[model samples]
Target: MALGSKKLRVYVWFTLPALLLYIGFFFYPALMGLNYSLTNWDGMARTYRYIGLSNYAAIFKDERFLHALGFTFKYTLIVVVAKLAIALGLALLLTSRMRFRSFFRSIYFFPAVLSLITIGLIFNEIFFTILPVIGEALGIEPLSRNILGNKDTALYGILIANIWHGVAVPMVIFMAGLSSVPKDLHEAATIDGAGKRQRFFSITLPFLIPMLNVNLVLLIKGGLTVFDSIVAMTDGGPGTSTESIGFLIYRHGMLENKFGYATAESIFVFAMIAIISYVQMKWLNKQEVGQQ
Candidate 1:
């Protein structure tokens, strides 16, 4: 009992600092934000009054906020689907017997090392300058203009930049998942006259589910909280068509100084992410269990 109690004390000593830091930095601020959300403070005001959910009610009625919420959901859906599909595909290709596999993997993963802002700026230039020249040369009407200039196609242009920057980690993750799949199972499946597709569906995919869940949550969060890429590329423009919830929060909170309202929106987003992620995890857990 003495030895075990000493070990527990040592563990607590090691963990206490990090736990306190987390509470100070994250938990405390979150509580403050929640408090602020119930108020009418503009952040610089010397005197502010608690409005008690007025901000939340106003946000629901605000058209721009509604539009941003819708836009973020759409972006999240497209991003999650595209990233998962492409990353899984790339992971499979690289894990297979192919020449210069390491070289291709490195090349594909290189973009992930770059900052989203840098990637956005580079793609911004490509859309603004290089693509137009190529488009004109090819006599393509759509390409002849700046892709980011049109609200209709701006989302896709932003998506192109995001996907390029985002897919690498998921690819690496899926590769790790693929590697853990037992080779002996594949050998057995092959002897049973199972083809590649059958084996993948029956065996490989089951193992990839947990990894898929992880990647899904990650992509969802990234999509929902996307900011820098949009700022660098669009700055919530082509007339607010590409504006996301994160950008809207920044615009209101930092730029417009509507701090209280933005905090309310932030809390709403927090709830949304929590609820969606929880539901997804639950559903995926069922899938995992079913596979077993």
Candidate 2:
């Protein structure tokens, strides 16, 4: 009993600092934000009154906010699908017996390590300057214009940059998952006359489902809260066509000083992310169980 008590004390002593920091930095701020969301705080005045749900109610009626929300959903769907497909393909290619496999893996993952803002800025120049020059030279009218400046195609520019910056982690994850798949199973499948596609669907894909879930959750969360790339690239410009929920919150809270309204929007975004992630995780977990 004494030994157990001593161990418990040691554990508590080790964990207490981190626990307090978590509560102070994360939990406390989150609760305060929620409290402020119910108020009419403007973030400048010293005194603010609790308005109770007016800010949330205003969200539905705000056309700009609704448009931003819609754009965010569209962006999330496009990025998640494209990122996963590209990452999985790259992972498979890198994992196969090929020349300079390690070199290719590093090349693919290099963009992920680069700063997203920096990449966005670089791509901004590419989209606005280099592409236009090339397009004019090639006599292609579609590419002749500044892509980031065009409302019709602005979101796609951000999507491409995001995919370039985001695919590395998922690729690495898939590589790890692929590495874990038993070699004997694959060899046996080949011996049994299973072709590449057949072996992939029957053997490889089943093993990768967990990693797929992990990547999907990560990509979805990233897509939902995307901000830095858009800020650096377009600043949600081209008539607010690329404004994500995170950017909307930023504009309200930081730019407009409507902290209460921003917080309300944040709460909605949080709820959305939580619900979507839960559904995906639950569905994926069921698939995992079925596979087992």
Candidate 3:
């Protein structure tokens, strides 16, 4: 008992600092934001009144907010689906018996190491300049124009940039998962006359379920909270068509000084993310169990 107590004391001493920092930085700020969401503070006034739910109520009536919310969901879905598909494809290709596999894996993963803001800026120039010139040369009218300026095509342009930057991490994840798939299983399946597709679906895919869940959850979160890429590329334009909830919060709370209202919107986004994550995790867990 004495030795266990001594070990516990040592562990507490090591953990306490990080635990306190987490509470101070993350937990405390979240609680404070929740409280501020109930008030009418403009972020500058010394005196503020508690407006209790008024800001929350006003969010549903705000057309721009609603538009932003809808656009965010749409953007999230596009990015998540595209990212996963391309990542899985690349992962499968890289894991195959090919020369310079390591080199190609590194090349594919290199973009993930670059800052999203940097990737966004690089792609911004390409979209606005290089692509336009190519489009004109090719006699493609739509490509010749500013894609980021066209409301109909702006989100799709952002989606393209996001997928380019985002696919690397998930590809690396899928590669790791694929590495664990037993060669013996593949050999046995081949001896049994099972084709590649049949073997992949029956054997390799079952082993990749855990990694799939991880990648899905991560991509979903990244899709929903995407702000830096959009900001760097289009700055929520042309005319707020690409504004996500994160950008909305920054615009309202930081730029417009509507701290309370923005906080309410942020809380709404948090709830949305939480609910979606929970549902996805539950569903994915079921799939994992079924595969097992």
Candidate 4:
């Protein structure tokens, strides 16, 4: 009993600083935001009055807010699917016997190290300058104009940049999962004349479920909270066509000075991320269990 108590004390002593930091940085701000969200603060007013969910009420009725929410969902869906598929494919290819496999893995992972804002800036120039030239040379009508200038195609341009930048980490994750898969099962399956696809489906994919769950949660969170890429690439333009929830919050709070309203929007985003992530994780956990 004494030893267990001593161990607990040591653990608590080590953990206390991190716990305090989390509460100070995250929990405290969240509580304050929730408090201010019920008022009409406007960020600079000396005095404010409690409005009691008026900001939230107005949020649902605001067309711009609604559009931002919808666009965020759409972006998240496309990014999650594309990233997962591309990353998994890359992982499979790299795991196979190939020339300079380690070099290829390093090359593929290089993008994950670059800042999203930097990537967005680079791609912004690509879309604005290079692609238009190529499009004109090739007589391709869509590429002739700047992709970021068209509301209809702006989202796709963002997706292209996002996929290129985001795919590396998930590929590394999938590679880690693939590495853990037992080779004996593949050898045994081959001895029984099982083909590559059959072995992959029966043996390999099951081992990948946990990694899949991890990647899904990561992709979902990233999609929902995306801000830097939009800011750097289009600044939520082609006239608000690619406005995301994160960008909307920043615009309202920092640009428009609607602090209370922006706080309300941020709280909504928090709730949204939590709910969606919970549902997704639950579903994926069931899949993990079923695979077992």
Candidate 5:
């Protein structure tokens, strides 16, 4: 027992370096962000005036900030829903014993491996060109008036590209979840005369709930952080109609030199994410309990 305890102590000592590195890098920076948000600080200023809650107050009063917040939440919600529904359907389809299934899965997952900037550039042409090369050869127009160039349609166009790009993540996760489900359960359901839809709802979907919960949270977080695609595609353009809170905060810190204000905005984004994640986790847990 004495030798075992000594080895355990040595193992704990070995893990300290990793823990210290994580605390120094990630958590320390995050705490500093919270601290800076309470001060009125420019980037290289000699003094940062402590402003208490003024920075937070300004966020509520700024019309542009409010608009950006609203738009960001709306964009996040829309893309998340679209991705979940589409990815779930694709997961179900591809998991079936269908033809050339590996090829189909690769095609679905391919976009996920592409860089965000590359995907944005490729889709930029798709949404802007009156006719793609193949479309022109087939005498079919691919699109009209650059979708990303218009104030009215620019935001919606971004959402479309995001959903298209994000589906593979959930699909892969769901495919894994589906595979882990017991085959005997599905076989028994079929033997008991459960139809396809019934079997899916009763057995498959119930078991998939945990993975769905995880992927849903990831999709929402990814949608909130969307920037590269929006920047490359619309440049927040036509009139800031597609401007997101992430970009708004970015411009504040880098362009306007309002570090404190940007920090406040970032804090707000973090809170929104935390609250949304908490609510979703609670709901998912409830659903899991009810299913069991």
Candidate 6:
């Protein structure tokens, strides 16, 4: 079934547009950002000065930026862990031999399909109102101040929103993975005097490793790169306690007109994300291979 030379040529021709599109939209912009990172450009100004490493140095020295970087990392970790655990639980629940399984799946996953900004606002009001109502009815109290407007609680609020919104993705993935596992394995485990927990741990859990790895990588990336939701939810506000690198870059590049410094900041973020994701991906991928 080898393709002829003409067919190969046709395939190459078809791929040309996609390749060009990648170069035009992605690679070119990335290279240009890297180039501008080494200079002091006012984005629109004609004259730009090359100041090697200064932008990078400034990022480290800027206390606010450092704080934001730490917060971003913390946010990524919290959101990923919570999402994984909750998603796995919900997935297991939905995958159990229950009636209206599809209904439950939709109930669990509806939030993940939403635009982040919309979800953020909806939850903001929900937590703001419904929590207070239940609290009053039950002799407790909701958060006194605005959740998203308070520095102490804003990041946590954002973290909760992210988890609530993101749980659906991993839940669906886990459900698919669970369904793909052979029922015979569970049945055999059951016959061997294995408890329900034993059968799950010995059989189903092991088989879900690959899907877990994929979902984890996606979760980590989304947590690290989250921007629109943050902006819509808090604007990294109440004194920048929840400010992330994404918001920092936008504020510098778009708001302050410090394009070069922003570019440098972006490149740093890219490096950090790549390094962390690569390490986690390699580790999880190794585990996946072992399971296989």
lDDT of the candidates, in the order given: 0.95, 0.92, 0.90, 0.94, 0.86, 0.85
lDDT computed for candidate 6: 0.85
TM-score of each: 0.97, 0.97, 0.96, 0.95, 0.92, 0.92
Residue 62 error, candidate 5, Å: 1.3
lDDT per residue as tens, model 4, 1-292: 9999999999999999999999999999999999999999989989999999899999999999999999999999999999999999999999999999999999999999999999999999999999889999999998899989989999999999999999998998999999999999899999999998999888898889889989998999999999999999999998999999999999999899899999999999889888988998787777763544
Candidate 4 regions with alpha-carbon error over 4 angstroms: 1-6, 289-292
Worst 10 residues of 6 by lDDT: 140-149
lDDT of 1 by residue, 1-292 (tens): 9999999999999999999999999999999999999998898989889999999999999999999999999999999999999999999999999999999999999998999999999999999999999999999988899989999999999999999899999999999999999999999999999999999998999889899999989999999999999999999999999999999999999999899999999999999999999999888877772544
**Predictions ranked by TM-score, top down?**
2, 1, 3, 4, 6, 5
List where candidate 2 sits over 4 angstroms from the true fold: 289-292
lDDT of 1: 0.95
TM match of model 2 to true structure: 0.97
Candidate number that wins on lDDT, 1 or 5 = 1
CA displacement after TM-score superposition, residue 30 of candidate 4 (Å) = 1.1
Residue 109, candidate 3: C-alpha displacement in angstroms: 0.9
TM-score, cand. 4 vs. native: 0.95
Q: What does candidate 6's lDDT look like per residue over 1-292, in tens digits?
A: 3568889899999999999999999999999999899999988899999998999999999998898889988998899889999999999998788999888888888897799999888877876777667767777544444567668788888887888888988988998999889898778878888998898787888788889888878987887778977887888887788788899899999999999999999999989878987887787776653544
Q: Which is the winner by TM-score between candidate 3 and candidate 4? A: 3
Tens-place lDDT digits, model 2, residues 45-111: 9989999999999999999998998898899999999999999999999988899988888898899
Cα lDDT tens digits, model 3, 27-80, are 999999999999999888988899999999999999999999899889888888
